[model samples]
Target: MADIDMAELGPDRTLLLVDDDAPFVARLARAMEKRGFLPETAESVAAGKAVASSRPPAYAVVDLRLEDGNGLEVVEALRASRPACRIVVLTGYGAIATAVAAVKFGATDYLSKPADANDITNALLSRGEAPPPPENPMSADRVRWEHIQRVYELCDRNVSETARRLSMHRRTLQRILAKRSPK
Candidate 1:
C-alpha cells in the first residue's frame, strides 16, 4: 500500500496502536510515523491499559483479539481513559460481533483485516473527515441472521452464551439456530 500523506494529518497528534501481532504492529507503527504521528505500541491488553492510563492517545487502532484478553476490554478502557480519543477496531473475517461491539463501545470506525495503510490513515481522520459507512447490500434480517451465526461460532456453539451475548432470548436464538441448521 502507498504511504499516507502526513500533510493531511494535523500536527503533533499521538496514536496508540494495540495489536498482539508484533510484526503487524511494527509495520503499522512505521506507516503512522511516516504520517506524522508519534505512535506507541502495546503488545497486550494489560500493557495497553497501562500506556493509556499514563498518557492517553489522540487516536487508537485496536485489534479485536489479543493474547491475554479480547481487545474489547482494551477499547473500553481506552474510552474511559481518553474519551476524546478516536478509536478504530480491527476485525478479522469472522469476528463481526466484536467489531459491532467496538462501535457500540465508542469506536469511531471499524475496518476488516488485511486492510491497507490507507485504510488505517482514513480511520484516524474518519471522525470529521471521512464519509459515513456505506449501507450493506443485505437486508436487516439477513444481517441479523449472519451475526447470530458468527456469535454461535464465537461462543463455540454454546447457545445460551450466544443468546446472552447477542441480547436475544434463549428460545429466540434456538429458533434462529434451528432455522439455519440441517434437519
Candidate 2:
C-alpha cells in the first residue's frame, strides 16, 4: 500500500501514541514509522504525560482509556506543552459525552477504536473541527452491537453485571452476547 503524505505533518514528524493495548500500539507504531513519523509510544497515561512533558510532539494519537487514568489528561498536557499539536482521541468506549469533553479539553478530533493506521494518519494530518465521518460508517445495528461488546468486555464479560449496568434483562443481554455481531 502507498504511504501517507507525512510531509504534511512537517519535519521530524514526531508522533505521540498513547494506548494500553500493547499489540495494537506496536502495530500502529510500525505502520506510522513506515508512513514517515517518528512515533513515541506509551501504554499508560502517566508514561504518555512524561513523554509529552519531556518533548512535546507535533502530532498525537491518544487512546481515551489507559491503564492509569484517562487519556484526556495527556491531551490536556500536550495542549499546554504545545498548543499547535494536533491530537486525535481514540476510544473503544465511544460515548458522546467523552467525545465532547475531549474536544473541549483539546483534541483535534475524536475517533472510535479500531481506527486503522490510515484513519489515524488522516486525522493527524488534517486540521479540522472534527475528523470526517468514517468513510464506511458502521450501520446503526452494527454500532449498537459493537457498543454492547465493548461494555461486555469492560465488565469482564459477566452477563449479570453487564445486564445490571446496561439496565437490561440478564437473558436479553445473554442473547445479545450469544448472537454474532451485526454487520
Give the winner by lDDT: 2
What are the RMSDs of all candidates, in order?
7.0, 1.8
- Kindly report which residue pairs in candidate 2 clash with one another: none
Regions of candidate 2 where Cα sits further than 4 Å from its true position: 1-3, 129-133
The window of 10 residues in a row where model 1 has the poorest summed lDDT is: 129-138
lDDT string, candidate 2, 41-151, tens digits: 999999999988999999999999898999999999999999999999999888799999999999998898878888888877775655555668889999888888888
Write down the lDDT of every candidate, Cα atoms only: 0.81, 0.89
Count backbone overlaps in model 2.
0
lDDT of 2: 0.89
Model 1, range 144-169, lDDT digits (tens) per residue?
77777877878999999998998889
Q: Where does candidate 1 clash, by residue pair?
A: none
Give stretches of model 1 more than 4 Å off.
1-8, 128-183
Query: How many angstroms is residue 106 displaced in model 2 relative to the true structure, after the best TM-score fit?
Result: 1.4
